[model samples]
Target: MKNIYSILFIALGLFSCQQEEITAEDHLISYDIEEVPVTEDYTVGALYVVNNWSSNIEEVPLAGHYLNGDEEAMKQHILWADSAAIDYFIFRYSYPTVNADNDILSAFLNQNTDSLLNFALRYNFAQMNLTKENTLEGQGKKEDFIQSFKDMIPYFDQPTYQKVDGKYVVNIIAANQFYCDSLELVYHELREEMSALGYDLYLTGEQTGWTPPARFEHYYFNALDAVTFTNMFNNAWYDRHVFLPQSLDQHWQYSKDYYMDKEGIELIPTVAPSINPKISNPNASTYIIERDTNFFWSILNVAKKNIGPSRTIIVNSFNDWNFNTQLEPADSYGSSSLQLLRNQTKKN
Candidate 1:
């Protein structure tokens, strides 16, 4: 009887150990047969928002909410981004604002002297409060608007500025909100101005196909070299509270078919690590996509598979705790997101 009881205890211990091993192995990402693609030379950039970092955030960062201009924080960020194999940092900017964004950009430029990683600009026109006169009709306002690009020439000339095929990459946020007679003309003029200064510009607009089948004219699509989103959320799925993988996957397919295949505009897909709008946008419909490393891995695979010839993918953000789409190290998931990113990038 004593021998039998001892044997049963040993068996239970063995089973427990096996279960633990399996659980640990499950955490590591594995590729599916279809997912293991003949990898392309892909470039990935993460949106880096410069904010008053001392403010409150629900998803506490591992390093805490440090100031935007903190040199150490910026240095750490650079190191982490490079380690993660991130190609560049896409920063949010606004015209004529010498605020936190400028301060952080200056800090980044000053610190990242060796050009360890590249950087790009995404001008949020929505923050500019431009009137109709400023966009089209007012005398010299059009030129004034064009001059903004010229002002950015110094930054573009930097060794760290992101470029593709000899043209500097610049993105416009809220371009759809630009109340103008011809949005196409505005972009054309901007390009012509840059050309005159011996600089080729690759402009990307962030205003196409929030809804699956885009209704914008063909000429409208021609305004920029490519189109992308800040965060590609499936509104219908969110509204219905059915956030499945297919809900997101179908959107990528739609963008590929409609924007790239049909319209001939390159679509730079933005993949999210996770999304939680509950904190910053309480009044808005509350939706949360829990922080799952596998979810990020899957979305990244989807993005890579659907990428246009440009071979570019934008991670929604590197540090946006408000909407909770950040890939930066957080208290709950320290460096795991970056690790996963590095894994995917290395595989490709």
Candidate 2:
């Protein structure tokens, strides 16, 4: 009987030892999880492409039909975008509207902080969006917008999750010079207020003619993560070398070199689909996007190679009617582009 009791004690000791071993393994599993490889084949790891600057420009908050169409109705149309595993959604909202609704903004940030800090936020400056002002860029509204962001920075600093560098992203689109002029001073002040916040700002502009000085020169570009281009053109204007297909790599290389050497910063890549103004605006100029999925795939491949990041990529837009680069799951394509994005993102 004494021998039996001794055997029971030994078995209990062995079980306790095994339990300790399992707990230690679980604690170290994340660190032990194979690090994301940076091999040639290990592409498309962390990348993204948004269609355009997004906006919650809804004045009435009518549930179904939003700024463009009905919410429930549009989902049926969001075929391609339904399963798109986009890493970050740079949701854009006008500065003026944010300025007016401190309470709403605070509530929104609180609710979304959980999701957005994990994602990305690219605040836009659409003067016509917030107010009925035809154009604020012409009327010293730049300063007003800058002041608005100064107020916004503290909120950006207090987020649930931030980028890999702990910096929050803010993007501006439009007259590059005007916005930059406002931002240069604003960011400096913002940095002071939120010293611990290593927040960065991104400035995007339409490729204003290929010329000197690059037009958009802001003091903050030096402190920015990247400067992106919004390709508003169709087919990226292929170089018709005697009707032969010009390699996308060759043309982009020169552009990349010039942009990097001259601007002293890397540029983001973008591929667009069809841009039809008739769908949304009759006055806007349209571009011919013959191949949608192939174009998207090519750009994704290029971005994966050049950026070489597991995440953070740019797309022309998800839905911009005037330039018609929407990926919002149309009944026509039936989620083809969106499915491709998900599948490609999942690939080796």
The TM-score leader among the candidates is: 1
Clashing residue pairs found in predicted model 1: none
| lDDT, residue 74, candidate 1 | 86
lDDT of each residue in 7-118, candidate 2, tens digit only: 9999999989887444422432112111222243321111112222224211111122333322343333332233465444344545656442343234334444235223
The backbone clash count of each candidate, in order, is: 0, 20
Range of the 10 consecutive residues with the lowest summed lDDT in candidate 2:
42-51
Residue runs of model 2 more than 4 Å from their true location after superposition: 1-82, 98-118, 126-146, 153-164, 179-187, 196-223, 232-251, 259-264, 278-286, 308-311, 346-348
Judge candidate 1 against the unseen true structure and give its global Cα lDDT, from 0 to 1: 0.74
Each candidate's TM vs. the true structure? Answer: 0.83, 0.58
